[model samples]
Target: MELFIRPNTNEINQVEIENETGTSDPVVVSINRILQQPDSSYFLEGIIYKVPEPLRSMNSEAYTPTAISIGPLHSGRKDLKANSLKPIYLRHFLNLAQLSVNTIVETVQTLEQRARYCYTEFIEMSRDEFVELLVFDACFVVMHLTSWQYPNLDTPNAVNLWQSWNEISHDLMLLENQLPFFLLQSLYDLFAPSQPLLEHQSFIQIVQYYFSEHKNPKLFFIDIKPLSVDDVKHFVDLVRMPNTRMYSHEKSDQRLLWPLNATELHECGVIFRSGDGIEFNDQGGCLQLPPIKIYDDFEKRVRNLIAYEQCHIGNELRNRVSNFAVFMQCLVQSDQDVKLLIEGGIIENYLGGINEITQLFNNLGKHIFIGINYYNSDCKKMKDYCMRRHHRWMTSLRRNYFSTPWLCASSIAAILLLALTLIQTILAVFTGFKERS
Candidate 1:
């Protein structure tokens, strides 16, 4: 009954619209293309990194360079105020190295690729630009460090430069703002004094000398050992390495911790005392802490060191400073804790209030990727003390009865009154029994 229309032979063919599963999305295609591309090769892993967002957000000022830019990451930051000084310092270095501009440029050009390889990411600059930044930054850093070590031989400009050292030092320790250690060393050796004032002193020693001035001078300068160049990656690393040995390497159980804050520990009858050494030790749970002078820019230095450790992809850096940061974060959880530490001379709170110190520590080590628990034994000791029945009883007695003179007097009066009532009741019962008999 169906009528089929066998119409004209030139009828257009019916086209069906359907979803095409085979067609690739532009994003997918691009990603696949990138995946198919050959991996970029470098002789060395990049040691520097732009501090990630989580850490930067916590304290934006800590990661931002305030005075100068040392390397490519922050090289052309618009806000950098020390650009004018770089060329001046470079000129001084040229005078010291005794190498012509063309010669220094050529030497750096040769090592340009290797130096680039030291960075973790591909630098977005031309070959000329990259080489220029490396040569300029390296020379500036080397010259700056050298001038400090040989102050007697310093130029007028060098002496003036020292005036801005507080800012310069902060800039140098930044995670993103760093040059390769070898590059600086090579530059240093090329221009080292004909008759060196310090024969065995290397660039690391010079750096240690400059940066360590803000730290406990007794610990930083006394019998300070020279660091080998092979393991160090940059100036920030050089700064971090000296304090790595501060802590003992003893093992501790994580679960067995004296996790009490300072006030609580004090309440638990634990004494807070200053540590013997002039620096904080990360040894397994040993409660030794060096006196910390919390200057205005202290957090910036500590944050940058931790960020560098987090960015660097190996145990070569050992993550000791970041570990110390984590340990401190764990140690100071409240304002009361800061007060206890201050009383103990373990923390010199120059930044003013207890809350400021608390926030400073709490904000640190958030991006600490490496896991190191150095205070396990110290925590365990405190935990054990807290768990003891004798300590608990004493603490309860002191808190309940001996807290103040008024409370003590009230408690004594109540006890005496109770005794008198019991005596009267016993006498009345005995008298009643005799009358009944």
Candidate 2:
């Protein structure tokens, strides 16, 4: 059913989330009607928020000094400059005239802040996990930007070789908050699942199963299997044609995707929605993010570091821990009102709990920082120690995680070799016995 929704924008007003197709009568939506006016407008899932768009793409080839833009809304990093920017590692960030200031990050942040202020209901997860996903998404953007900025015209790799960034001999650094989402997406396509399938039918079966398996059914963070942009496109197509089964039982080709409800379908159609909520139709679930700005040619260089990090970063658990800490700190300290789509899901507080928590922490921080000494000096010191230990535990976790892959690979190889040797010995004994007979 065709449901109408306001596209994500800087100028959002009362937007109605209509369930034109009477399928979903979930308590969440029913509750919403009672709490809010029918005509009242609200932010919905899958709505493409108005974000900074680079006017007439320009990269190193077209512009001098590699004048890449770090959009105001999206730059999570604290520093910004015009000419020479601070290098986070190798890439440089500078505001360009062509790049717009509006970004999804900013828009979302604005809503988050508002929700906090208004005490709106929010879906709560591990602060660190949510942040880790943010980093993961951001890394994807950086990877794409870098890949486009540094095209393979003068290099040996004309094919997608962003994955092999270890060949670089120079000390490269990004001078600012780099686009990370685009980076991850391009690389993700290059390395999708590679198991042998019987046919298109088998392939669809496997792929469908892969997407449906709920490693994090309620939360689509850091799971090994990530939903791609293509998946979203396919899902959009499905929404456009509701009668057609995305995945066919008899046909060799089937598209396995989770269905979206009226509100979810409408919301996700424009802005990307987290896969936790119920779509108008619950065929299954999806992780497909909406289309981001594509990075072509030399612009790809903005991403090499991110690519390298994903492939070479050994401390996965530790990295997650740190990401979690930062995310938690940000969420706990955030003074923003966040929004949560609790229409099709079973979130008790929805977006409300977040506001409550953030407010709780805000008050605590203010009291502690603003001469309202609630805790004694020793207690404060103990708190500090606990934080330090918490961080240390994360580092240790990462170390253990890094060790697993090598250990598993080596063990598997050894076991296979031993099995082969045993088979050979058994064959030899059987042959000798047959010859004697």
Candidate 3:
């Protein structure tokens, strides 16, 4: 029997619909939308970024500003009590500079688009809101920096303001809580010419002086000749300058394999000395590293710095802070390693226990890719130096026998007794031989 073949209704309807209207497929439309979007270079223009999930999840509080928010990322938070001081500081800045509010507003408005481009996220605030925020935040930052010199005695509690300043300093250094350095410079330049205190000082110099005195004392030792204000991205980058300048970029294909912990390296006759950067002397079996000061906020600062490097720095060779973190992680495996580094003066432990220090290093370098480690060659040299059997034996001997004065004296006495016993045996043998003759 011949059956009438029925056409597939859905396919026929789809074909008819396509023919009736000039419409692209859903996927084609999506592809076109994607093609119209900007490239990676557009995103690369952004200096400010939200700390990625892999890092943020590790320590949320480290990346989050506790005291205040600088830029749009953490703006309008009710919990941040320092947000209330922004308007007050803005008024103080205007009064000090003898400039009208419209002057700074116009200045910020002119650079609004440029400032917005600095952030990776799409800022939800309107042009007016964003501009006002910048003016208030920028003024607050300048006043905050010089707050130590110009204490606000008008406030009922001067002591509380001082405490808030310390907290705010840390908050300003956070990766997310940052304004563009150029915007800050522009604002500072407007009033700087008139102020006697800021007459000779550039914004960069002021920043250098403030951070050096308060945040990082080691900044005084770092040669900032290679750094310029134009090169600095933000406060996080400013903090990173000393580290980036500490080491020259060297590429290596080798990875650090079998990295002995600090205590193990010490046992293998490898000496660790605190210095400006990571270096290894094969001849002397010495490893020199800058002394890492572990304070309460040290991990927070380091995490933010690492997060900045991860987001901004494309080249691993230039990821000095991240590379250092990786290197430290390799050297610190346990509390013993931390103690050894502490005893050797390689690490200054201000956070109380060695376990915390150990955990600090161990927690770093997670969920990050380390390419072209700066200390690879030095690590290899150290590992090779440690491989020698003689060095290990000598180190063992010295550590075991000469570790204490009593042990050293006992070792000497034992050696002398063995020598005397051998000499007495020889003398008796000679006498017996002579008597036989």
Per-model CA lDDT versus the true structure: 0.69, 0.28, 0.76
Q: Can you tell me which runs of candidate 2 are displaced by over 4 Å? A: 1-42, 45-69, 74-79, 82-223, 230-437
- Residue 35, model 2: lDDT of 53
Which 10 consecutive positions of candidate 1 have the poorest summed lDDT?
9-18
State the weakest 10-residue window (summed lDDT) of model 3. Answer: 1-10
What's the count of clashing pairs in each model shown?
A: 12, 85, 0
Q: lDDT score, residue 401, model 3?
A: 94
Q: lDDT of model 1 at residue 231?
A: 71
Best by lDDT: 3
Give the winner by TM-score: 3
Report clash pairs, candidate 3.
none
Q: Candidate 3: where is the Cα deviation over 4 Å?
A: 1-41, 149-162, 215-221, 242-245, 256-258, 315-317
Summed over model 1, clashes come to 12
- List, residue by residue over 1-437, the lDDT tens digit for candidate 1: 11112121121211111122233464544444334333442323557677878888888888878888888887787777776677887887777657799988888888887777677656777788888998888888887777766876466755455467778877787888888888887877777754367467767777777876665443223234666888778866766664434555564445523266666666766655565442322222234566777878788877877777776664643566776777678778899889878888888877888799998887675767645555566565667666666766776787898789999999899889999999999999999999999
Which is the winner by lDDT between candidate 1 and candidate 3? 3
